[model samples]
Target chain A: MTKLIVEVQDLWKSFYIRHNRNDSLKERFISLFDGRRRERREVFWALKGVNLEVAQGEMVGIIGPNGSGKSTLLRVIAGILRPTKGSVTVRGSVAPLIEIGVGFHPELTGQENIYLNASLYGLTRKEIDRIYDEVVEFSGLEDFIDVPVKNYSTGMYMRLGFAIAIQLDMDILLVDEVLAVGDEAFQRKCLAKMQEFKERGKTILFVSHALELVSELCDRAYLLVNGQVILEGVAREVVACYHRGQIPIRHE
Target chain B: MGSWMRGLTRIIRYRELVRNLVAKDLKVKYRGSVLGLLWSLLNPLAMIVVYSLAFQYILRIPLENYPLFLITGIIPWNFFSGAVIASSEAIIGNANLLKKVKFPLEILPFATILFNFVQLLFALLVFFPAVFWFKTGVTPLILLYLPVLALQFLFTLGVAFFLSSITPRYRDVRHLTEVALMVLFWLTPIIYSISMVPGKLQPLIKANPLTAFITVYQDIIYWGRLPSTEMLISMVLWTGLSLGVGYSLFRRRQRVFVEEL
Candidate 1:
């Protein structure tokens, strides 16, 4: 069997929703004296007991309705969010494209931001130097490499972000709705690059709302609803289940 | 011990990221201005002039070359205060990166401190000529400047770590730090000599962590003498205490930084 490169076991994550945010000292001090003025808070569970496993080289897609904890799952796997319960075991390094242009400083030139963004993934200067030309070529931003990214169009910005993520040498890639930003031609290029990534035996966990694309590109998929996985199987079948709007009764 | 070693290795592995962050700050800060680096000197220069007028001419403090004494103490003090103030924004300012990337969060505050340290080095470079002109020429004791500066950096870094970690939870931390620094400035012997303070208040002033650092700078650069053993011991102890408390607190709170932010 192929090695399980990413394994998430009964993972859970929660956030606090404050009705009255007393993050300042004055409010905290006043609240201490007046019981009625105490801030109200509610626990928000973004992910509930999620279990997932991905083998090396497999491309998996996660689909869910808005606010269904899809992006939260990817963030947790990327180690941006700590699990409230259970644990995640990732055997290989992860390049999270969770949000394109994440670490890009707008005041910095495109070339400078490329170095800064790549370093966020723990790449040394030498490694970035090696991949530098290829990333610029792939993004097709050769003309504006020296211009600050604040001046770049949204499409151009995402193209650079996508180029940097794909060009890096990492074992696992977590993509979260990044394809939605770029133009059609750039999106097509991205799809081709992802296909190439697959051919090169890299693992990918993709989160997207594009049903047809998920069906076509992923080998397997999971459908999540209200922070719980409702269906998991071959990509097409999961997409079919989602299309039918079927909600299976849970014994629990 | 094992976890500590792992943390060390992780920091070493991400040294490139630290370098990139420091570089980014420098570029962003100096990008548009033609006077870029000279601007860092202006604040300290203004302080030196104002204090020289008030204490040297107006109050008659009796210390010769008061501007020289002020330069040594004020420059390093500015570094400490500047770093501490900036640290409050370090983690919160990078909310986007913290939410999306998984690299060490500690680098954010650390890079802020280093950015201020770079400016301090520049200020020193600009003022060392003045020190030579005003004070009695070179002493071998001046060789101790780098080690004293190194200890000050670590102590400030510790304060930074502590402040940056807590600021996300308490948004008021930045204001509190500003107020605290205002109070600390007077308590530290920057404009006046330590000898000016009554002997009873001497111990109280010396108890401040910043006092040892500032006095050591004054001793080495202005007095042209080796620091007393007490000052040396205090310097080491403050660095150790700050780093130990600040880093452990940072480690404990870092896990929840994303959640808090």
Candidate 2:
């Protein structure tokens, strides 16, 4: 049996919403003296008691509607957002393709941005140098590499962003609705790359709204609504359930 | 202590990210300007001209070589103020990156401080020659400048971490920091000598953490003497306290920064 590379148990996250009419010093000072006029705040739970497990080399997909905590789940697993209660354990390094070009600076040239973007993903300078040529060649922007990224066409920009992420050979990859922004050819390339990672026995958890892509790429899929996993099973079966509208719209 | 060590190791491991971020900041700052990197030198030169004319000719201060006195204090003060001001928005300004990426949040403030630190070094190189021209002359005590500077950097880093972490919650912090820095500039003895103030008020002025730092800069750069033991002790105390307070506050608030943003 393949070992579990990712395990999340009883995960919970909440945010506090402050309700104050005035933030000015004078009002705050007055309110401090008048104990009756205190600022009010409300608590909001974005995710509640979420549990998930993915074995090594497994390809899993997460699907949900807007405000369904799909991205939140991915963010928690990627270690970007802390879970308020419960635990998340991952055995190896993770490469998060949640948002391409997250740290890319517009003023820097393509070559310069590649290094900065790669480093943001926890790649060492030496590691980036080792794969510099491959990343550049793969992006197919060799002639425009020296030009500032701000000047690149949107398609060229997306190509470079995807290329930098796919080059890093991390143990667990977390992808979040990123492939939807690229062209058909780029999407095809991304799908093929995911397939290659699967063949290499790397674990991947993808979040997407595209049901067909989830059905095609994921071995097993999870359906989340209102911050809880409503269904989990074989990818095709879960996709079918979602299409059949079994999960109703949740009222806040 | 174990957590602190882990934090240190994490930061050390990402030193290259720090270097690259600092480099990127410097590059972006001067990218579109006509003067480009020359502004780093020209900015202090302009301040010397403006402040000397205002303080010496207009106010008729008796201190000789007033420009040298001002340069030593002004350069270090600029570093502190620049870093602190940038700290106010370091986290908020990078909200998108913070939401998407999972690196240390302290890296933002660290990069902002180091950016100003690099500019401070350039300004110092320009000021060093003025030291000779003003006949302050170098002393063996000047070797102590580096250790003192490292201390100030730590203090600034700690303050940066604290302010950046809190600013997201208190949007007013950005404006508050600007006013606070302006107040702090005059509070320290940057424009006038501490002796110029009444002897009774000297201790009060010295109470400011930057008092010791500014005085030390003057001792090594202008007076050619070693900083007093009292001044050195105060510097170390402030540095340690700020780091302790800043790091703890930062660690506490960092987990919730994403939600707040």
Q: What's the lDDT for all of these models?
A: 0.90, 0.86
Candidate 2: clashing pairs of residues = none
Cα error of candidate 1 at position A127, Å: 0.3
RMSD of each: 1.3, 2.2
Q: What local lDDT does model 2 show for residue B218?
A: 88
The CAPRI classification for model 1 reads as high
Model 2, B64-162: lDDT tens digits are 899999998988888999899988788998898889878877778888888889998888886778877977578888898888899999999989988
The residue ranges of model 2 lying beyond 4 angstroms of the native Cα positions read: A19-39, A248-252
Cα deviation of A29, candidate 2, in Å:
4.3
- Model 1 ranges off by over 4 Å: A249-252, B1-4
After TM-score superposition, the amount by which residue B55's alpha carbon in candidate 2 deviates from its true location, in angstroms, is 2.2
Expressed as tens digits, the lDDT of each residue in A21-45 for candidate 2 is 4344555678888866667779888
TM-score of chain B of each: 0.97, 0.96
